[model samples]
Target: MKIVIISLLAISLHLTNSQITSGIVSDFVRTNLIGYPLIHEPKTWIFDPDVALKRRKQFVDLHGDKGEKLIERLGLGIDGNYEERLAEQRKRDEGHLGGLNAHLP
Candidate 1:
């Protein structure tokens, strides 16, 4: 009975030690060898312009005027002309693609 308990405790300690070592090795490889990993969904502000612009559009749509304030506070690295840029796009659409109203009636 005592022998079995000691063996079980030893096995548990061994397993815990292996898990800790594995975690340390994994972190070392990711940090020293991998270096920053690849970008994916949700996106960050490191160097993705498309993500930043898309986030701006979504944010403005959701928050309206306050959205711009939050965007400024966050410093999303855009041209800071969301309204002007959209207006220009609309103007271009009107001139070239006949605008969004062309499909009406």
Candidate 2:
């Protein structure tokens, strides 16, 4: 098929013209792995989360209590005590996990 030929051509060209760079890998990450554009004009996930999240708080809202474990599983941030953070956040939210609203006290 024409699509296959195009892919083969692209791969061949890529191999000849460039070494494996982060941007090239980032392009693949953004395109196929994560399916999210390079937000902030940068940053890409190495593997697919397989879900769409438009806003930061949508993470917990989408996954519920499992959200904390999900962050651990996905390596979403620096290695730290995520469970502790969640517990603290819950106390602040009165045991509810919701989106942030800086305007509210």
What is candidate 1's lDDT per residue for 1-105, written digit by digit as tens? 686557555655676687775666566557765664553236656676688767876777776656655754444346787667666665677734434556565
What lDDT tens digits, residue by residue, belong to model 2 across residues 1-105? 687557656765767545554456557657765786544466566875644454546766665556766754454355677677667656676734355555667
Q: Which whole-number lDDT from 0 to 100 does residue 23 have in model 2?
A: 56
Worst 10 residues of 1 by lDDT: 68-77
lDDT of each: 0.61, 0.60
Which TM-score value belongs to model 2? Answer: 0.21
